[model samples]
Target: MNLCMIGTGYVGLVSGVCFSDLGNQVVCVDKDKDKINLLNKGRVPIYEPGLDEMLKRNFKFGRISFSTDINKAIESSDIIFICVGTPTSKKNNSADLTHVYRVANDIKKNIKKFKIIVTKSTVPVTTGDKIEKIIAKKVNKKKFEIVSNPEFLREGEAIRDFIYPDRIVIGTQNKKVNRVLKNLYEPLVNKGAKYLNTSRRAAELIKYASNAFLATKITYINEISNLCEKIGVNVEDISIGMGLDKRIGTRFLRAGPAYGGSCFPKDTKAIAIIADQYKSNLSIIKSTIKSNENRRNLFKKRTFQIMKNKIKNKTITFLGVTFKANTDDMRESMCLKMIPVFLKKGAKLRYYDPSGKKKEINKKVKFCKNIQEACLKTDLIIIHTEWNEFKSLDFKNLVKKNNFKIYDMRNIYSSAKMKQKKINYFSVGR
Candidate 1:
């Protein structure tokens, strides 16, 4: 199939590459001329594993291309996928659909024949109906079909997830359209990926609800970690015990810093706003949001206690700064909130992430080129993101200072081992 993917952000770029690798011709369109130029050179703007190689391979085969000309791409393709960002609105938590609607208006002008317009972007419910209404105002209803096919790609492991997703959801009641979409995804469907056909609205809601539930699980485990700390218990043992139940399989149950990523924080708030607009009370989700926020502050208090309120002039090193490792995204990273506060309290900070330096941190904070440089002579080592390199480290050798403390935020290291070495180690729960 010839496909046009609009807005070459994470979703657009990754999906376009994956589709092309599956033997489909794909053109990824974006307003950013620089990004399109980069993609045309077989280089990606985002840092996703295996994406650059896959993109370069497909581009070499003439299967994938990038363009700033939206109308031309739209005219040439049989299927148009809208993969623009629908960021949370400033005034309210509802999604700001300006980009999505703008793409719809652009599509209306360029549709020379029947096209299946699928929204691969995360959108609110009824957004497909709204897009259909917009396009119908300018073009005939039979000319195009609006679809809500939300993406389930996680940041770090997007490539693997796309190739082997747990499920593939297509939202459109039209039987003919459903058949076409099923054919489009037949490769994955053959690989045992469940294909579900549902109403467009249900498909849109599924993405948001799925994210909110995962956020709830993270918050649930984090709160449990707090209680475990008070009563002297291991949160991992609890997570293991609870996960043995068929009802709860462990995925997001790791007790760590508050859930912060492109999806969770924004989606949780948006879902609450959506529920309220429908005159429904989603008190549990509301509490989950509140609890996630408080989790950050709780970590702040723990830090102060660990330091015995002697933050002034203490040299602290953060192992990783990105929300989670294996990707370079810093959109709601817990360190974004904590780093500045530590600086204000007179703690000199340096951080080294596997993803490199972050712009979100204060200018005063030094960016170390490597972990060894960041840890040299530092008073405290806070294991923030669980990057692979940080998992097994000779911390005593890295710090090279007596009485240095290690705070394992992700619980990646064993507390018993730290104790055996006579290192002052702190971790979540136990």
Candidate 2:
């Protein structure tokens, strides 16, 4: 199958590459000419593990290609996937579908063949209908079927998620579209994959509900972590015991500073607003959003409490600045919020992450070249994100240069080892 993937952001790029790797001819379209040039020049715009190698392999096989020419890509493909961004609106909790709409309008103007226009981006319910209406008004109505096929890939491990997802959801009323989508993903399903076929609206809601529910799980654990801290209990042990039950499977139960990334925070807000628009109050999801915000603030307080009388005029080093490890994405990272508090308290700070070369951190604090540089001569070391390297760092050597008052926010270090080092190690809820 030939697939035209619109937008080369996280979802689009990974999906395009994966589909191409599956032996489908793929032309990934992006509005950014610079990004397309980079891709064509064998450069990946995003820092995903093993992506460049896969791109090279697929590009060598002539199964994958890159382009800024949307019309050309659209005209040549039978399936056009609108994998553009539906980022949260600034003014409200609604999703800003400007990019989706623009792509729809453009597709309507150019395409002549019967195409399956799949909504691969996470969108609100009934957005497929809205997209269908827009395409109908501009093009021949018989030429396309808008299928809501929302992606469920997580950042940092997107390639793995894409290759082996929990399920493939296709939403459409047309039987033909269903059959075509089934065939499109037949390779994966044959290799033991699950499929959920539902109405377009239901499929859309499934995406939002899944993300919101995961956010709620994290928030639930975070809320419990707070109580555990107050009551003098190990939340990690409690969570582990609770997760052993068949009913409460272990996932997203790790207590951390908060869940802040490109998805959870925004999707929870958008869905809560969606429920509101439908006159259905989602109290739990609304609280989940509030819980996440409260957790971040609580974490900030906890950091300060650990640094009581010690943070004043001290050099602090942050281990990871990205929201999660493996990706350089720093949208709404807890460190972004926590760093200012330290700066306000008159602390010299330096941070390091493999992918933490973000503009936000560059403007605010010193960007260290490596972990050792960030830790050098710093009084306190804060591990914000559980980057793989942090777990296996030469801690004995790290503390040799400094007093090593550590705040392991993600609980990456064991309490026994911290005591062995005679270090003051503060973790979440323990």
Query: Please, what are the lDDT tens digits per residue for candidate 2 over residues 189-244?
Result: 88777988999999999999999999999889988998898999999998899899
Indicate the worst ten consecutive residues by lDDT in candidate 2.
Answer: 395-404
Report, for all candidates in order, the number of backbone clashes. 0, 0
Runs of candidate 1 exceeding 4 Å displacement = none
lDDT of 1: 0.92
Each candidate: RMSD: 0.9, 1.3
The lDDT per prediction is 0.92, 0.89
Superposition error at 354 for model 2 (Å): 1.6
Kindly report which residue pairs in candidate 1 clash with one another: none
* Model 2: colliding residue pairs: none
- Writing each residue's lDDT as its tens digit, candidate 1 over 1-430 gives 9999999988999999999999999999999999998888778888899999999999999999999999999999999999998888999888899999999999999988999999998888888999999999999998889989989989999999998999999999989989999999999999999999999999999999999999999999999999999999999999999988889987888899999988899999998888898998989899999999999999998899999999999999999998898889998999999998999999999999888788888889999999999999999999999889998899889889899998899999888888999999999988
Please give each candidate's TM-score: 0.98, 0.97
